[model samples]
Target: MTAEIFATTPEGDTVEIVTLQNGPATARVMTWGATLQDFRLDGTPHSLVLGSPVFEPYRSRMRNYGAVVGRAANRIAGGRAPLNGATVQLETNEAGRTAIHGGSDGCGYVNWSLASHSETSATFTITLADGQAGYPGNLALTATYSLDDEGALTLEITGTTDAPTFCNIAHHSYWNLDGTPTLGGHTMHIDADSYLAVDEHKIPQGGPQPVAGTRFDFRQPRAITTPQDDPKLDHNFCLRLPGTEMHPACTLRAGDLQLEIDTTEPGLQVYDGSGLNSEVPGHGGVPYGPHGGVAIEPQKWPDAPNHPDYPQITLNPGETYRQVSRFHVTRI
Candidate 1:
């Protein structure tokens, strides 16, 4: 593991950037938000993801660019949910009425502690106090990023709570295979028969709806900006359940670069960078605009607390939470 001082927090805390290398792939991870600062392959001239060159933009501008999001990965309606047969009010950070991504006090903004590091892997840990984000229990979470010689990067997140709480951790990385100005030409294919429908505020309507005959269908590879593509997409695509084994969830291709996203989670949220308009220049001094990249977040179904039919997101006192996801890039 190679480390360097990345930046210092406003509170006078030190933050570092750790780099893990394996064969042709190199990943630079920052302690702030446990975020992926840069990912590059040996022969590639451009970085694989959209990210700022400094820490300030990550905190002030970039929506969740390559951060470890949690407590709850998605929204909870009315800023409240049921816990132990009672209502638990949550901190509202989205439009002042809903709790999105653990209410802005989420793990994405916290500086995680470096748990351990080696040549090819690094682990970062964060502790979420009970009721810190309006959730119960004290949650101890660890996010580990590992890269193999075969050019596959795996992110494994594990958590354990001291009391009953809601925990759904997901990696939020905006990927741009070629690091181009726009991802409109990128081809994408998601392995999902149905996707959760969302309302105007991007909240899940009720349950999963069939993707057939709809723009959500990605059973086959298609250009991301085709007529079938929606102007803005923040919906969660429902995958096969049980989630005991990792499987190929989606594939994104841009020219000669291809990225295969696989995960053990049953849901994948696809964001096409529609709302990205950043003043801070990304790596290589490129200003990221709308559709600058695409985010493929793998985790539990959104708003699971209110919908009993969806998969559960609860973590009991003695239970452990685990999610495994991989991003494998190759030249086509």
Candidate 2:
């Protein structure tokens, strides 16, 4: 592991970026948002993940580009959910109707303290005050990134709350295997046979729906072209029967580069970069726009706290919340 001062925030806080290399993969992680700034492989000098050229873009235009999002990674309908037989209204951050990514208090918006680091691993820790973002709990969160000899990058998220609260964290990395202008040619395969149906606001509507007759199906490898109705995908696919362990979720390929994603979570949200039209300069002086990358986030189902039928995402006192996601890259 190698650490350097990446940038000094406007608040006078110095942010550090740690580089971890193992085998054919190298990853750069930043303290701010515990973000994955860059990822590359041996054969390709080009970065496999989309990132801004400078640090300021991350605080403004590209806030979610490569951050660790939480305390609930997805949306909660009406910005509210029932906890312990009572409704808990959260602080709305998405158009004042839903709590998306834990609002301003999400882990992605804050800096984390580097707990430890080694040649192939690094761990970060952060504390969320009780009632912060209108959630009940003084949460202690930790995220660890590790790279194995086989070019597998694993992100393990763990949290414990003093009170009962939601804890569903996700690492949001926009991958562009070819580092091209778009991800239209990337082929994707997900192990899920069902997906959650969302409303116009991208909040969960009904329970899990079969992907057999829907465009959400990705059981077989297929090109990830954007649909005409919706700009791109942002729905959660159910991968487990609830009460299962870690398993393979999806695989993505672009040209000679491929990534296999496996996670312990039950849901995987695939977001094609249709909304990333920022003119900010990306790495290698590339101008990022729509379809520049794709984000595959693993977490508990969106709005699971409200829907009793869905997998639960509650973390009580003394109980730890844990989720692990691994990305195995290969040159094909």
Candidate 3:
């Protein structure tokens, strides 16, 4: 493990970036948010995911670029949910209307501790106190990133809370397999027949909607964007209810490079990066703008706490919450 001090937070917390390698793949992970700062595969000329060389952008403009965002990965209606027979009000970070990504002080924005590491794997841990972020529980969370001999990257996250609370985490990485200015030539395929419908506020309305005959259909590999693309996606594609076994969720391809994602989660959130205009540059000083990359996040359904019909997001005491996801790239 090659580790170095990345930066210090204003709170006087130290952050470190660690490098792990196996076979043809190398991943640089940081303690802040347990982020995957950069990922590179041998023979590839550029990073597969968008990132920054310095920590300033990550702390400011590019908060979620390559971090594990959570407590609750997506939105919660009105920032309120019923927990343990009582209603709990969470921090409404999104427009002061909804709780998005566990509120403003979410795990993604906080500094974590480097627990352990090997040459090809690293684990980061953080603890959220009871009543913090308006959630009940003293939750201990761990995020581990590992690489296999075949260059596949695996992310395993686990949470155990002293009290019942909500726990849904997602890796937020904006991927651009070709290093292009935009996702013009990228094609994607998601193994989902339906997706959640959202309101104007981007909150789930009710049940799942069929993807057939809709622009949301990506059953077969298709270009991420066309000139006539409508309803820029920031929605979740329903995979299945949470399960113990991992399943293939999606695949993304650009030219000869391909990325395959498998996860144990139930939903895949596909954000087209339509809102990603940033003055701060990305890795290698690359300018990030609309369609600069696409974020494919696997997690539990959004607003699960409010919708009893949706997959549940509650983590009770003595029960361990676990999510496993793998990202493998190959020359296609």
Say which candidate scores most in lDDT.
3
Query: In candidate 1, what residue range of length 10 has the lowest lDDT sum?
Result: 223-232
Off by over 4 Å in 2: 226-231, 241-244
Candidate 3 CA-lDDT value = 0.93
Steric clash pairs (candidate 1): none
- Give lDDT tens digits, candidate 3, residues 84-198: 7899999999999999998788999999999999999999999988887899899999999999999999999999999899999999999999998999999999999999989
Candidate 3's TM-score reads 0.98
What RMSD value applies to candidate 3? Answer: 1.3
The CA lDDT of each predicted structure is 0.88, 0.88, 0.93
Ranking by TM-score: 3, 1, 2
- Residue 116 in candidate 2, Cα distance off native in Å: 0.8
State the weakest 10-residue window (summed lDDT) of model 3: 239-248
Model 2 quality (TM-score): 0.96
